[model samples]
Target chain A: MIHEYLIQLLTIISIYAIAVTSLNLTMGFTGLINLGHMVFFGIGAYASALLTLNGVPWYFAMLIAGILASVLGIAIAAITARLKGDYLAMVTLGLVFIAIAVSRNWISLTRGALGLPGVPDIIRNNFYYMVLCMSIAGICIFIFYKLINSQTGRVFQAIRDDETAAAVLGKNTYFYKIISMAVSTFFAAIAGSLLVHHINFIDPTIFDLEFLVVIVTILVAGGLASIKGSVISVFALLALSEAMRFVLVSPALIGPVREMMFEVILILILLFKPKGIFGKVDV
Target chain B: MLSLNNICKSFGGVKAVDRCSFKTEENEITSLIGPNGAGKTTIFNIISGLTNPDSGTIRLLNKDITGMPAYKIAQSGISRTFQLTKVFRNVTVKDNLLIAKNTSEAEMKKMLESVYLHKPLDAIASELSYGQQRLLEIARALLKPHALLMLDEPTAGVNPRVRQELKLILKNLKKQGKTILLIEHDMDFVMDISDKVIVMNEGKVLREGKPKDIVKDKKVLEAYLGK
Candidate 1:
């Protein structure tokens, strides 16, 4: 039983690490504050669930889910291209509400609030599944590292720093922002697919504020724009949260208390460091 | 090689640039001088495509570039600096030139050296003094080959020593056959460097002539010396 719990814990950490890393591309590197990252993840989960139920291969379902999520990302980026700062944040925040409402009301597709269950496992053994997830996250981090080191990445940073100057230097920043959004959403969907496959369940509630807070807190506490910081923070925070499960607290208070703990940690970090452990620059 | 023909721009109901027309000849330093709010910088903004002229045309090599987006204009061999320099503060000095997407490492080194900003290549731009940051902006602008370079008050807030260095840099750029359109308020600096001068008032050209002619024009003195 302990072994199974360890495998499950590692699996969850792997999935959240991938999601947060993808979010880092936008929120951390590109300097966008994306409150709607969970919408893309949820979209990927539902898409994967629906496709696999219709007899699509698991990898193919994942691909389709990623594509669909990227399309949603592009849509959001195009619609909100002219907005910045608080306006951009509010628009993205609205996307989460919209996504949740769609999943709840579209009973024919998502089964409404009941959600889909018994999602097929990509690999049968828990240990192998965990390894596979870890490998995928590793590959993604490598790719992100390569990308940000390239000329393309420099332009993203330039735009993040001073958009007017970037444009004046011939960056075509609007196009790059859309590309960042699409790429970020594509990886975020992969994380969602991994989540459904590992747990064998799906529901609208999976797109919860808890997930959003967890992802953001991990990024902030880890350090903004630091890939290594993001990876390590994910593992550390997941471990911390899991450790709380054994604290002998009342079962009812566990969830709220854990959430409160994250909020407190995030606040303290913001007040003190504001840059996560590995952050070399500001968000 | 660049011309603005009857360019006009307004904010709400205030006319920032009103039917302003001027041309920057090849390899010449054309200094645009005007009192504040006389719309000199607004003209540069229009030419650089930061703010589209509400009406009228901008031409580069007589090709109508009116209302093109700033980046697209930049791609066509025009570059500009802001009145307040806009260096990417956190990134390394080398990364600033890299962001321009038009310079190799050796070229960037050469460009930085030319600007006398031969600090550590990996130094963060914000670590530089304010004058160095301004020179860094100029270095980043000239990283790529361009037919026209527009500087919006390049010496604003700069120390006199750095301002002297800037004059030399601009003179060197001119010797290499680069056309420059400058907006400056310093009469001595403007007279010393500019091949030609264009005076503006209330978004219209007050006079255009050789620098020697402009300094002696009664209307130019009246506009500058006031009333």
Candidate 2:
């Protein structure tokens, strides 16, 4: 029973590992301050859940969810690509609130605050599902690793360093920016699909600002722009957080203590390793 | 060959580049010299598609390139270096050149040698001296073959020795049949290398001629010496 529980916890960590690594492509590599990135995850979850509930095949639902998320990413990029720094961040923040509002109020689509339940499993056995998600996450990371090592990867980092210089060098920055966001959201959607199916439930709250904070903390703790750092930070932080769950304290205090502990650890890490444990680029 | 016809750009209500027109013949060096705020850099911006001209047409190799995005214009065989060196600060020096476009190992080494840059290939760009950063930018621009190379203040802040090396590099590039457009405040360097000089004052092309004639022009003298 303990083995099953540990595998389930590791599975959740693997799913979020995919999400954070995907976000790193933008936040770490491209220098996009995408606060509302989880909105794509939410979109993926709802899209997949709704389609599967309405008799769509599970694989088809996953594909549609990824496509829908990518479309939204392109739209956001189109509108926000011209805006940078705080303005772009504010726009994405506004989008996150709007997404939550839609998820909370659109009863016809999202069932409002009641949440979506009964998502179909990828594999019947929990351990097998864990293996499948790990495989998917591994592949996603591998593809991103290759992409970042190519010529296109250099341009992406170049744009992050200086957009005008990158453009002067003949890189179509606007196109690259859109492509980066689209690819990132596609993988984020896949992680979302995995999450919804694993827990068999999802809500607007699952994609809230609190969740974004967790992702940011993980990325910072790991290292911005370091793929190895991101992977290590995910496992280490998740394991730490999971171990905290076993503390022999009052259950109510556990949540607050864990939150406070993460904040303190994050502060300490920033003080010593401003770039994170493996950060090559400053966030 | 590159041609600019009546290119004009205004910021707010101030005209930065007004009716700027010129042509660059292949395999010659043309220098744009002016007093500060004479719109020399703005004209470069317009030609390179960094800033859109409110009115004008640009033709490169006789193809219309007016109002194109910077990257498209660059892809059409034009490359430029900024007055402020814009080397990618975090990446290695070699990675900086690779960011422009892929080149083989031999080409990368050749470009570094052409610019006389002896810095280790893996050194971070920001760690280089100001002159080395400038050379790094030039090295990056030379990574890919372009019909025209636009350099903005390439010698600014470099030591005298590096300046001489830069002169040699420009002369060699011109000898190789590359059209060079330059903006410089160094009169001696301008007079030494430029095949022709265009003088601008108050956002307008005040005069154009051979280097000797430009120095002799009364208006050019007054533009520099003041009334």
Candidate whose TM-score is highest: 1
- Residue B21, model 1, lDDT: 85
DockQ (C-alpha based) per candidate is 0.78, 0.77
Candidate 1: tens digits of C-alpha lDDT, residues B77-179: 8989999999988789999988875466788888889998868889989899999999999999998556789999988899999998988898798788788
Per-residue lDDT of candidate 2, residues B1-227 (tens digit)? 99999988899989888888999888899999999999999998888898889998999999999989999999899889989888998788878988876877677888899899998888988899888998899998888557899999988888998888888888788778778899999999899889989999989999998999998899999999997
Instruction: Report the error of model 1 at residue B29, Å.
Output: 0.5
> Every prediction's TM-score for the first chain?
0.97, 0.96
Candidate 2 lDDT over A227-264, as tens digits, reads: 89999998998888878778737788877777776787
The DockQ-based CAPRI class assigned to model 2 is medium
Q: True-contact fraction for model 1?
A: 0.79
